[model samples]
Target chain A: MRGLLFSAAICLATSPALSDPLPSWGSTENKSTIISFVESVTDPTSPDYVTPADRIAVFDNDGTLWGEQPVYFQLIYALDRLKTKAEADPSILTSDILRAAAEGDLETVAAGGVEGLLEILAVSHSGMSVDAFQDDVRAWLDEARHPTTDMRYDAMIYQPMLELLSYLRDEGFQTWIVSGGGVHFIRAFAESAYNIPPEQVIGSAGPTEYVDGQVMKLPGIDFVDDKEGKPVGIDSRIGKRPIIAGGNSDGDFAMLEYTTAGDGPRLGILVHHTDAEREFAYDREGHIGVLNRGLDEGPDRGWVIVDMARDWEQVWPE
Target chain B: MRGLLFSAAICLATSPALSDPLPSWGSTENKSTIISFVESVTDPTSPDYVTPADRIAVFDNDGTLWGEQPVYFQLIYALDRLKTKAEADPSILTSDILRAAAEGDLETVAAGGVEGLLEILAVSHSGMSVDAFQDDVRAWLDEARHPTTDMRYDAMIYQPMLELLSYLRDEGFQTWIVSGGGVHFIRAFAESAYNIPPEQVIGSAGPTEYVDGQVMKLPGIDFVDDKEGKPVGIDSRIGKRPIIAGGNSDGDFAMLEYTTAGDGPRLGILVHHTDAEREFAYDREGHIGVLNRGLDEGPDRGWVIVDMARDWEQVWPE
Candidate 1:
């Protein structure tokens, strides 16, 4: 039994499948520049060196780290939730978003705008305890498939960004996600997906209340953590100003501003989605993942605008 | 030069202060019981073992981790802020709390109850960005001394609790301070004083808003994070339900209840302030730090009620 167990263990340890390395995304000048700057800051002998305490890096979620092609993944979750709820409660069909969602016309529902989105979200998100909501998110992620990609939303995460997160961690940098998405929803998957722990994820939050005689937290959509609230959420949650920040839109402009304004070897990179072949390519005029003012002003502010067409060889995990 | 450097390094490495073993605080029966329970749950070989990912411990700040006599430390900070603000604008003297504050009568102002406290906290905590508030907290902590003890507020922390935090961390437990005090105020000292990071500190928070192009997160007097809010804040911020909880008042009873109700080997401890000679001995009917319901029902619920007078040889750091 011992000899058989030893052989099995040796096979497991040396197996090609178990030891398979992460796919290589050919390096670019942009990647090298980012790596070099981080190296200088992390190296103790360097003049611009920073300690582990000072090594804070923030990344935007939607288009920057993951594919946000067929609308935001959160919106899709909200839509599916709307459909399910509508089936249980026929009265929900009277709601405009629900009606559109029941018909599977996501485009029409989205076109109904922010109010429509908020209505869908408020109904789907509220009335559940925080733990219940987390479990719901975990369950949904486990089974929910993206509409366009037909893959698990988590698997659609950009492989290159995952590599960056790992590389930064190896260099003692604490990585964080500063998103406009719901804090708890992202927190549920961030740890297992990116290796960034829940404590490090700062995002949109709602007011929460405890039910009497229960150990549950319920979230109410009172505060949307986007635009100016992005910087605020980061300040309130992380306390430390980020030394490195990555984002893809004008919504993330404030975070980029706050991070780059800090003294020291700071870095601000904007992932410009300009690959129409593999991904969408629209900067100033794109309705989804809009990058208007940020694209116009990034070069002047010394922020590197990552051209997706030229920079990344692949966008999603194989 | 190399030979001399090597000799100096060797001498420093072999220095008595670096090499000599320190004396142990003879682990009493109480300490052993607590350590043994924690070890059994945390040790993988033990049947009751818990994973490191699930090892969560929560602590109360004020009277449990530190001394909060004569006045709550944050209240003292508020009074000082009131005096400073009043000095600049004598018009603030028209306010009841400010008037009492100006006359050096804090008890009179506080007697107005929660409303009075809120007024004082509003003027003291608001109208500043989160970063500015943190800086002010740091500055105040540096200069401020406790009224009765004449010691720095940070120094008033119980040395045993500080050791407990380190011990818990060494045993793979993530320790958090879930207090009724302002989160940022506790966060300012927690990292340096107890090694608990800012993200791990959850407290009563006032509604925060974005004003004048900056994010202002302030404490509101209305949102007392006591009673029901304790569990609410814990669930919202920590995400994971704590396995171990330490507290001292009726305000913390809800937290203890929330923690102990979890499955498996959980521990809940209540610190009874029974050391009038060394500290202060007042509970149940006491106006401050009341421990009425918890004291009576703790044992029935399997919570360990720590008798401070009898259980501890030392209170605060000398």
Candidate 2:
């Protein structure tokens, strides 16, 4: 019994909770690597020790933090708006883009590529005050349930990722969302969902014009924050290069490259959706969050590829 | 004699050093109001108490924090670069705008208005990496002296304003520079001169595009941060409205209006240059830092107009 107590005490001291600060993450190499990297950089005596303001960690939103399976959440919002408007006034659907969007034909709508998507967004989102848009988004997020699991879109966010954000914030790091998503869309939920303040979130911005004592979002996207545009968005919004970057798609490849390329101990994490049972798992030819180039190049760049099935004990919050 | 000694001891107990925290500011109504507001907002027991994150204060850069005459310091940098570039390639001066800029024709540049000024900035600032442009601006600021005062341009920053920044920071306010000047240009000196970090400085941006392995400034003005643009820029960069705003020119009138209009006990200050003997003093028809609309509308808006000759104990630092 004495020996058993000693073993229990040793187990308690060496427990994963004591060894790993990231509770939701499993005892995989990816989780251990992340904890070790965070430990090294945060240590005062470590050569890689970075001050709080300089400890910037940028993360991609769509697939990195939440599920992007049934198309992006923003696209879902856009399509629903188009359907409502078309039903109210058929004239508004004179354009093929609106008709396609209203029909939920995403492939045709996406065939227009970035420019076509921006066109649809402009038609669906313009002519409203920022506050009004924010209110509308809030109302939608409140009621909109994911078709796959019947969970509120915000509730579908990764439990492990949320823990990671809290962990980083606890360590005095300023976390930011550098996503290929719309700035207005992400700003609406970033603070409540990720604990990252509005000023820290950087993404593609639509044109905004101030008129009649109100700022209105112009329907056109002035920039794209995907692929190479990721680094551009980071530089434009955040003047400094981030030390840590996390993403789950090829679109985030450039951001990870730009972040980890900087000298010293840097971390680039790619969250590979490998759990087909607990969550939707698709890659490369997948409709959204395609993990193609990142998978091939991650090894070359010393990036940690996180296998969701193996690395995360809890996929979604209970 | 005993009575006189007793009075002296009482006077020592109520010394101004212990009472008035802002020493550089004269014992004026403006200074008192500032202190009182800060005290009320910082005190937990006070009904008007504010959280630290919500205690944001935005200050106009030119004329408010530093001198913007004979022209904006950024314009001066642009013109100097235009001259240097034109000298290297005479053909570069073929453009009418470049010719006018190189000749120091302020009237023509001003007449061309926002578009013309943006055109000039694009010409002067494009085709360089952000780092290169930053280095160029840094080198110029280091060597450049004000023609009028023969003092280093950085040294021309307001002494009383410096004290105010420190005081506000000490009281947990995050002070930001909301300038009509170029962001890249202002970011170079904001940290070193005013202790405002690069991320906190919001200004007009020249066109920036991500290129091969580097982010380059495209030769065009994307957005202007003056007048209505100031409020728009604030909303774009910082989603939260600041409680306190300060400016010195008609250009800042809109920003002051927007900040003070928010729901709260707000403070708006207009720095009026009433000291011609110490510094340049011009109002409605001034070449730069024009102070017209603000002076006329300040009284009705309840904004405290700071008289440079009276409210400030000293203008430039010794």
Candidate 3:
């Protein structure tokens, strides 16, 4: 009888209803707000109830889901790949920007600006089959580590964000990743890292050609899924406005605005990275993931600005 | 006792396992092949068993799903819209092609060729918000009927194909529509007509802009999801090659080839429209959806050419 009672207690404690849905989220107003929003939309009796089919939650990939300090992870992968290619064929690094990128000269590459960055990306990412490029990305992810943290890129994914994703999915919301990063680059690890499927990911893409039977990535910019492009990407890809939009920078401001501006119940979340001890912290003046406009007007728009240092009990998974 | 037995009998007759999954499909080789392929992939004991996540099935929309006879339904819609716009402002129809389209002169428009057709499509389809365009399409679909059949375009959807879709879905395969038609146009009716969602429907798209807060359609082709473009679009959008591909035209040749060429068990289906009594029968030499390459190579590639007149017991929903 005692054994039975003990077992029952254990079951009760571990049960889905009793257990914390977002264990990494600290006991804060933001946590409660997120839970309340999800519950209100999921409860059939609630006026804010949304159908499972209509319960879409979109998230930005870089910085929002994982760390993107120093540089975007995709750029790191591209530079590393470019270096290997240049070693095999030195003529491939014709331009100074290409040579700088291949040599891991971040300062010189940064000075080259957007055009040079695009050129480097096009040269590094294209000329290979889509299958081959994805394979290379997978291989790099398996071997590569972050410059500062010495941790695998996938391992840097936010534990709190993962919990939020699971909780939303538990409440019948479909989670999608809308990123300014390369679509192919994000797709390579999104499923395993964040539980987001390839089809559910929308991002900047380059032109691809179907040569014989294989689809080959081509040299050139096709579309940029950033800033104003975020809204356009969401509309074209998902064909439905998300009920919830989560991001960490101004790149996602349009996405969050578009989502919240829709009729009925909506929520916009901006993860303010302020945990200098656990994770890198920079926002207003940062070169990457600058949050000037978002920081200024987010609170006024009824958007929840989450302080990572205060709201998260844990940064990364155990 | 008699009533109870009768109730039991009715239950057995109506049971999913006992009832025919594809009742509209005749007891043909094509039907058997489809069933066998689905069962093989779904059965855990089978060597060809595929996980649910990888069980993707792609389908072409237009003539493959419904009728594209007199012309593509979208062109018909475009002409009708052009006529209305011309009525409001006669100056809008400045070009010869535009005037011909507005006056329902399809012969003259056809003579104007692809360039003229694109011009007509751009003028009629663009310069409106995505939401407004979809709403306009919905309104048009509600009132419009086929000039010859006098049946609603949505009603002309194949019954056998509908059953096939439901069956594949039951077997845990995700169904997607890869069409050459306008993405916005197909999205308007796809959900209601085929039980396929807007996001699952990939098609040719025009440029869109994010103005103020709305995603407005702009004049110009963004990407054409036809011929070789089909494979490119599938790769960019879905990010996975489908296990099963169904199409009725040369435009889908690349897509079908790409799917079948992928490693492991795969199936390609070509719907041969031989049901002149119920639908259009033109194929190899038809102006739209020409199947010169498909008809010649399909059999050699182990593709199941579905003879609509013989394989289907019913053409359209009653």
User: What's the TM-score of candidate 3 when only chain A is evaluated?
Assistant: 0.95
DockQ of 3: 0.71
Error of 2 at A105 (Å): 3.7
User: How well is each residue in B144-209 modelled by candidate 1, as lDDT tens digits?
Assistant: 987767788888887777767777776788998989898778877888888887767877777666
Give each prediction's DockQ, rounded to 2 decimals: 0.38, 0.37, 0.71
Worst 10 residues of 1 chain B by lDDT: B17-26
Q: Rank the candidates by lDDT, best first.
A: 3, 2, 1
Residue pairs in collision within model 3: none
* Native contacts kept, each candidate: 0.36, 0.36, 0.68
What TM-scores do the predictions have? 0.88, 0.90, 0.96
lDDT of 1 by residue, A217-283 (tens): 3334655667777776676666667889999999889888888887888999999988888777777
Residue A250 accuracy (lDDT) in model 2: 92
lDDT of 2 by residue, A1-318 (tens): 466557667877865446456778988888878888888888899998997778989999998998898799899999888888889888887677778888989888988787778767877788797778888888899988998899998888999999898888778788989888887788888888877887887778788877654678887877688888898777767777888999999999888988887788899999999999999788888668888999998988899998999989998988
TM-score of chain A of each: 0.87, 0.92, 0.95
Global lDDT of each model?
0.78, 0.85, 0.91
Better DockQ candidate (1, 3): 3
* Runs off by more than 4 Å, candidate 2: A1-19, A87-91, A112-116, B1-19, B87-91, B103-120
